[model samples]
Target chain A: MLKVIAQDFIRHEFLETVRPLYQELVEKTRQEKECVSYHLFTDQKDPGYFIFIEEWPDRAALDAHCQTEHFRRLVPLIDSYQTREGTFLLMDAFSAAADS
Target chain B: MLKVIAQDFIRHEFLETVRPLYQELVEKTRQEKECVSYHLFTDQKDPGYFIFIEEWPDRAALDAHCQTEHFRRLVPLIDSYQTREGTFLLMDAFSAAADS
Candidate 1:
């Protein structure tokens, strides 16, 4: 299995404006065939910042997600209120045994 | 081996306010025996937002990291910031196959 983790920061005030749209996109992402899990989180002290953590069965699943129409359609909606584009600046995948 | 993924977001302006300190903490984390990788990324379009992605060998290693003095000392320094407190908000761990 391949696991992917991505992060992005956003303005605090933007949370109110983007929460609804974010929920829609997350719902769509969660439904994807390869999605193992997906979620959103906000900083407790810093309300402006938020984070999204995702897990996929493999790179192929993640790649397919990138090509989906739902993913494509999200950009414009995200751009309207976002001050900056989120970036997957870090990427790593490797085989391993379960730690437990 | 167990892979741990964590995500947290910070405001754009706060990015600068905390970059130096963040880098120090990350450096300390990377030196831990179980760390496979650690990184920080800023939004391409948004100056105020940033993310930290981490990978650890297992829960034991990750737990030890939390107890380290560097980790302990980081709190008060981080608390001095203006807006909100950062949160680990999301954490996931599992074994995996290399998806090359």
Candidate 2:
């Protein structure tokens, strides 16, 4: 499986303005293939920071999703939040005990 | 194994200011027991966005890491970037084939 994770340290003052964009991207990612799950969660301990988790059947499928129109539009808006700074992570996963 | 991922959309302008902080973190996390590997990567397609991937031996070790002093300090400095808006993700991983 392929797992991709990212956390954004957004400006707290702009939190309300970004909610609609967050909601739109979440909905769009869920509709894609290999997207087993996608969610946006806030840190109870950290108010403005958010995390995004996505799981894919394999890397190729994940690559395809990255090229989608939703991804294209989402990237720019997401970048807008980079007014402060954020990060992106790409991970290749190997699991030892699937049924454990 | 346990997997944890996060992405931070750092302000492009402050990217250099956060470099020392990022380096300090990579070293600290690398020394932990469950950390098979942790890397900070930039999106080739996007600038100013960063991703973090962490793998642990199990959940217990991960839980401990969270309570560690490194985590306490890391959280606050990271939150300072919330000038725009960001995210955090917590995932429970189930693998079908670890030795595959």
Candidate 3:
């Protein structure tokens, strides 16, 4: 499994404008066959900062997501609103056996 | 609910030392009545860096967690291994209707 954590610090002015777009992206992204989970979180202290935590079956699945029409359409606008392109960290998950 | 995303950049030298402590912490934390979920992830590109994603029923639950003997014992050691104290972000989660 591939876990992706993306931290996007958006310009305060764009918070309201981009929220709906994110809502749509989350909805559409979850329907993809490769998506295990897709969640969106906003910083409580700074609403403009959003974090996307997602799980995918593989890199190909994630790549396919990036190529989707909604991704292409929405991501650019989302990017434009950010102070930086955003930070993406790919991770390997670990869990204690007791919890697992 | 209170969701916490903590990013820790551990000193490469301390990776081996902290792994077991973290594992123990995760196990103990999940056993707490107020803990909704707890997950640990290590950055693929940088094994020394870790991200902890956690959920608690409320502030009291979180505060109680901070007071745990295991938490108190392990966290300081974990913090000592980091280059910087680490960045913690409190977030409000949002999900698409299709998902919910």
Candidate 4:
């Protein structure tokens, strides 16, 4: 599986505004055929910090997701709330005997 | 919910040795009453890099989790495989209307 871990820090005033967008994004992303799972979490120590962890079957699946209308639209709005450009880490899992 | 995002980079040779331990940990952790979910992921660029994303009902549950016999035994074994001390970021999910 292909996995991504992304982090963002929302502006203090924009928390409420950005949450619904995340909710909508999560709702839609989970419905995609390639999506294994998607989650949004906020830091306990920092209210503005948000992290998104997602899994997909492969790069093609993730690429297809980025091209979706909802994702294309959501990206610009999500950008406005950030303290900095978000960090995105792409990862692949090691196959273990236990995976079977 | 309480969430944790943890990262570790294992010595290249130790990857094989560590897999079963993580598998065991995931299996046992999932059986815990407090565990909502637990996931293990590896970085696409770096085979040695591992990330864990976990969720629990609350801090009390997580605290109890750490005290479990399996977890206590697993910690040291995991540590030996590490290139550096791991990072553990504690987080809480925002209570959006969407959560309802």
Candidate 5:
């Protein structure tokens, strides 16, 4: 499985504006058959720091997600509110046992 | 729910030493009743970067995890191999709708 950790630091002032967009994207993405899991989180200490922990079956599935309507429409809007460029960490489960 | 993203940048030479310690922790943590999920991942682009994505029912449950025998035994040994200090991001789900 391919796991992604997408981290963003949004401007404090744009929290209200950005949240609904995230919700819309998340809800829509969850319906995609390729998505194993999709979750949105905010740092407890720094509310503006957002993280999306996602799981996909493979790179093709993830690539397909990027082309989805919600991703194309909402991601750029969300990017405009960022304090800095977001970080995307593509990861693999550390062990076969951990994959379970 | 409490979600934690624990990131570590391990020294290159210590990857072998650290991997087993992390596996031990992950396996044991998954057996804990309070642990909703426990996963270990290594950045695909940076093998030395490790991330632990964990979920707990509440603060008390998370605290109890810290006091577990496996955690106490493995974490410090794992820490010793880090190139720099690890990052611990305590986070909350961004929305109630996203919780499922």
Candidate 6:
């Protein structure tokens, strides 16, 4: 499985503006057959900082997700409000036991 | 609930040395009553980079986790092998729907 930790740092003023769109993106993404799980988290100290913890079966599934209509429509719009470039860490479970 | 995204940059030379310690830590931590979930991941492109995605019932549970014998014994030892100080982001779910 592939786990992605995507960090987005938005300007404080844009927090409310970006939240619903993120909810929409997450809801749409979760419906995809390739999506194992998709969740959104906001930093407790910095509400403007958001993180998406996602799981996919593999890289091919993840690549396909980026090409989906909702992704294309919402991601660029979401990026426009960012205070800085986002960070995406593509990772694998450190132990096989964790995969379960 | 509190979710912690911990990023650790380990020296490449210490990867082998740290793997078992991390495995031990994960195993022990999962047994804690306050631990909702705990999983470790390694960056796909950078073997030296590891992340711990942990969930606790609350801040008190997380604080108690730090006081545990296993945590006290292993975390500092684990930190010693880090190339740089780890990044710990305390986070909360953006949408209640995702918490399920």
Task: Report the number of the highest-lDDT candidate.
Answer: 6
Q: Determine which window of 10 residues in candidate 4 chain A has minimal summed lDDT.
A: A91-100
Q: Measured with DockQ on alpha carbons, how good is candidate 1?
A: 0.05
Candidate 2 is scored at a TM of 0.47
As for candidate 1, its clashing pairs are: A12-A48, A45-B84, A45-B85, A46-B84, A46-B85, A84-B46, A95-B98, B11-B48, B12-B48
In candidate 2 chain A, what residue range of length 10 has the lowest lDDT sum? A91-100
Candidate 3 vs candidate 4, DockQ winner = 4
- Badly placed stretches (over 4 Å) of model 3 are A95-100, B95-100
Q: Candidates' lDDT values, in order?
A: 0.58, 0.66, 0.85, 0.84, 0.90, 0.90
What is the lDDT, from 0 to 100, of the residue B69 in candidate 5?
96
| Model 4, native contacts kept | 0.77
lDDT score for residue B42 of model 5? 91
RMSD of 4: 3.2
Candidate 6 lDDT tens digits, B1-100: 8999988999988787888899999999999988999999999898889999999999999999999999999999999999999999999988734322
Task: Tell me the spans in candidate 5 whose CA falls farther than 4 Å from its real position.
Answer: A96-100, B96-100
Report how far off residue A36 is in candidate 3 (Å).
0.4
- What TM-score does each prediction get for chain A alone? 0.73, 0.79, 0.90, 0.90, 0.93, 0.93
Better of 3 and 5 by lDDT: 5
- Candidate 6: tens digits of C-alpha lDDT, residues A9-77: 999887778878898999899999989999899998888889999999999999999999999999999
A83, model 5: CA deviation in Å? 1.0
Worst 10 residues of 6 chain B by lDDT: B91-100
In order, the interface RMSDs are 13.8, 13.9, 4.9, 3.4, 4.0, 4.5
Query: What tens-digit string does per-residue lDDT give for candidate 2 at B6-95?
Result: 667777766666666777778798888777877665554444566676667876887888787887898579658645555544443322
- Model 4 chain B lowest lDDT segment of ten: B91-100
Output the lDDT of residue A51, model 4: 89
Supply candidate 2's per-residue lDDT for B5: 59
DockQ for all candidate structures vs. native: 0.05, 0.04, 0.49, 0.59, 0.55, 0.51
> Model 5 chain A, poorest ten-residue lDDT window?
A91-100
